[model samples]
Target: MIEAHALIKRYGDRRAVDELSFIVKPGQVTGFLGPNGAGKSTTMRMIVGLDRPTAGTVTVAGRPYREHTAPLCQVGALLEATAVHRGRTARNHLLALAQTHGISSRRVDEVLGLVGLADVARRRAGGFSLGMGQRLGIAAALLGDPAVVILDEPVNGLDPDGVRWLRDLLKGLATEGRTVLVSSHLMSEMAVTAEHLVIIGRGRLLADTTVSDLIDRVGVGSVLVRSPNGADLRDLLVRHGAEVTGVEPGLFQAAGLDAATIGDLALAGGLAVHELTPRRASLEDAYLELTREAVEYR
Candidate 1:
């Protein structure tokens, strides 16, 4: 479990993260999502003690990361790339980390195998591809067999297969009762991977709820309908106390009315329907709607 209380970070007058607080529960994948420069990275840095918080505090397993006797073993972090000595192998990097925590070399090999880096255990990290580097980073994170995992933009720069692998791995960790905190710009991927989300903007909390709750908070999403009898349908929907918008020449967007009601109205009034569908309500739209007033820079 991870917790942040009134976490705040500032550089001069610019507030990178302000009064942000949230909890990451075990057995769930919690997503940290926001636009570019939304303080996701800064907050993560503060959490793991990579950067100190200006005002507030963050705890991993009820203690700050720096205070832990064996910090790596208590919290596994992949905040940086794996750039070991060009001559040293991947296994050596992990072994060195294991040595720092007084862990055995057997655990190093276990994590190497777990992250599918056993074959390249002898390969120099400098020669590894980006995907391989990411895997090695993951192997290092798992080296301590930590109970809580925090990843910032884990899928960034990764290929499709690697992205899916990371997603599945995070999901698997959460399923096994490990707390997972993943920060990403990929909302669509987050939609599939994260059970709960903490949305922020301009260094403030916009939302802290389940994915479905955030979607529902978009004030009952509507569908875009295009009908030859657009005006007629709009009038009918208006009469039924529904919000209707004439978006184009022959297209109208309707809310407060379901498809069945619209269909029954058109059928009873002899109005021909051209097209109707339950539109996909994107998380981006929901986020934009919620953070429209919270954004600091336009």
Candidate 2:
């Protein structure tokens, strides 16, 4: 598990992360979400001890990342996929990382196959494609079978097939009871991959909640009603405190009311209800609502 309590990071007069606290528990994938300059990368760096916190503390499996007996074995991270030695082969890079913690050559080969880079294991990393480079970074992260995994935009350069594979792999890791914290700007993928979310903006915590809860908090959603007696239904709905907007002659969008209520009103008004569809708020909608004001740099 990963616990961050009142974490803060600063560079000169600017604060990148400010008193952020969130727990990334085991057995689930927690998505770390924010805008481009929301300090997500800075926070991730602090978690792995790559950058020092200006205040507060963060721990992986109960201790600071640097304090662990074998840091790599405890927490595996992919901060930058392309930050590798240009001279080394993919296999050699993983082998070198394993050597730091006395990890075996067998584990190196295992992770290479696990990430679908076995075919290019002997090729120089600099010559690999973007997707291939990402695979190698993930391979290094899994070399020790670490208890905690932190990946920043793991699917940035992946193709559709590679993206699907990564989704399955992350879910599998969480199922194995490892703490998985993934940072991504892809809302569609996060909606399907993450059970929980940690959303921040302008270096402040905006939300730390489940996907369903976040959607609910944003608002149940507006209801779409298509009726033959649209005129009467609109007046009836407006009188009932619903904010209704006409999409066309026969279709209207009703907010501050549910489908059941709208349908009942239409039926009571002798209106022919053609359709009463409740469009639930999506993750994208909720995210935009929460972060609209908090966004920095426009």
Candidate 3:
């Protein structure tokens, strides 16, 4: 498990991460979300002890990463970019990492194979394409076989197939009861991949909730009605204490009434109804609602 209590990071005059606090439990993938320049990198840097927090503390498995023996074996991370030396082969880089924790060479080959980089294990990393570099970086992160996995923008620059592969891999890792904390700006991907969300803006916490909860909070309830007599139906629904809105010129959105009840009302009122569809709130809409004012740039 990873827990942060009032974490703060400052640079010169700016507060990069402002008293951000959240707990990421094992057995699930928690998505870390924020806009550009929202202190995401800084926060991750602090978590791994690469940057000391200005205030507060963050612990992985009940200890700060820097305080742990075999830090790599306890926590694995991929920051902004894969920092592999251009001259070395993929196999050599992973071997180097594994060796740091006194891990065996066999583990090196195992991770390389697991990340599907075994075919190019001997190829120069400098010659690798962006996607290949990402795969190699992921291979290195897994070298320690750490209990906590932290990835910053893991799918950036990946092809469609590569993106899907990473999604599956992250999910599978969580199934093994590992703590997976991922920072990403990809809302659509997060909507599908993340079970919980930790949202930040301007280095401050904005939300920490399940994806479904956020959706429900913003979605509330809305009814989609297709009928020629929309005007009449709107008046009736409004009179009955239903909140109404216009989705389009003709179609009306209704709240406080179920489809079945709406249909019965329409029939009793002798209205020509063509369709009635309900739209539950979506994660994208909920995220926007929560972070709309938190965005730094237009």
Q: What is each predicted model's overall lDDT from 0 to 1?
A: 0.85, 0.92, 0.88
User: 140-206, model 3: which lDDT tens digit per residue?
Assistant: 7788899999999989879999889999999999999999999887888998899999999899999
TM-score of each: 0.84, 0.89, 0.86
Candidate 2 versus truth, CA RMSD in Å, comes to: 2.7
The deviation in Å at residue 130 for candidate 2 is: 1.7
Score residue 112 of candidate 1 by CA lDDT.
88
Task: Return whichever of 2 and 3 wins on TM-score.
Answer: 2
For residue 123, model 1's alpha carbon misses the true position, in angstroms, by: 1.8
Q: Which candidate is the best by lDDT?
A: 2
Per-residue lDDT for 164-194 in model 1, tens only?
8888999999999998898887878998999
Residue 169 in candidate 3 has what lDDT? 93
| Better-scoring candidate (TM-score), 1 or 2 | 2
Candidate 3, number of clashes:
0
Local error of candidate 2 at 198, Å?
A: 1.2
Ranking by lDDT: 2, 3, 1
RMSD of each: 3.8, 2.7, 3.6
Residue-pair clashes per prediction, in order, are 0, 0, 0
- Candidate 3, superposed: residue stretches over 4 Å from native: 220-223, 229-272
Question: Backbone clash tally for model 1?
Answer: 0
Report the poorest 10 consecutive residues by lDDT, candidate 3.
214-223
